[model samples]
Target: MRPWTLIVVSALVLAGCTTTTSGLMARSNDTEVKVNNRNLGRDLSLSGLNRAMVGGRLQARAELTSKASGDLYLQYRFVFFDATGKALESATDGWQQLNLAGGERRQISALALTGEAVEFEVAVRRIVDE
Candidate 1:
C-alpha cells in the first residue's frame, strides 16, 4: 500500500545513487599554486588579512587593479580556525582565480567566515611574474 510505495521509491533512489558513488568519495588531488611574492609586501601582505575587519559576508576576492600602477596575480583560499588555533571547519581545497592591475588598490574585496571559527589563513598567489 502506501508504505510499500515509499519503500519502493527509496530503493530506486538508492539504486540510482550507486552508479555515481564510485568517484564521488575519492580524495581531491593535491595542487601547488605559486603565490606571487613580489606583489605582496607588509602593506599588502597576508597579515593584512588578520588585521582588517571584513564587513558583509564572505569577502569576494579582489579582481581588478586601478590606473595600471602595478599588477597583482592573486589567488585566495580560505581556511577557518577556532579561537584555539585548531581548524574549526573544513572548506574545499581549491584555488580561486583573481586579478588586479598594478595600481588598482581601492577595491574592497574580502570574504568573512560564517561559523565560530575565529582565525583564518588566506594564501595569495601571483598568477603572472612580478
Candidate 2:
C-alpha cells in the first residue's frame, strides 16, 4: 500500500462520513429554524413550542404554520434529550406524516418514552415520493 494511496482512501472515507442530511430543525430554546430545502423551507415555519412534564416524561407541543397558498405534505419527528443534551431514543418508527392546508396552523405533540428526557428537538421534512 503506497502512502499517497492510503491518504486518498482516508480522505474519501472521511468525506463520505461528513455528508449532511437536509431538513428543518427546531429546538426548544431557539425561535430560529434551520431549513435545508428551499421550497419546503420557504413555505413552512415553526411558530412556537410548549413544553411540560407529564407522568414523569417530557411533553412537547410544536406549532407549525404554512405560509404557502397551497397545501403541503410533510413529516415530523421528535428527538428526546436529557439534561446533558444526549439523545434518549433513536431508531424511531420513522417520521410521522401530516397535511398542512394553505395558511393553516397546527399543533403536534409527543411524549417522551423515558423520564430522563428534559429537552427535545423537532425535525420536519417534506415527504418525497419515488
Q: Model 2, stretches more than 4 Å misplaced?
A: 1-19, 90-93
Q: How do the residues 2-113 of candidate 2 rate in per-residue lDDT, one tens digit apiece?
A: 9999999999999879734466888886777888888788898875787998888888879999989999899998888899988887335368999999999999888888
Question: Best-fitting candidate, measured by TM-score?
Answer: 2
Per-residue lDDT tens digits for candidate 1, residues 8-41, read 9999999978732110010012222223333344
TM-score quality measure for candidate 1: 0.42
In model 2, what lDDT does residue 30 have? 79
Off by over 4 Å in 1: 1-70, 90-93, 106-114, 128-130
lDDT of 2: 0.84
- Count of clashing residue pairs in every prediction: 16, 0
Clashes of 2: 0
Error of 1 at 58 (Å): 8.0
How accurate locally, in lDDT, is each candidate?
A: 0.43, 0.84
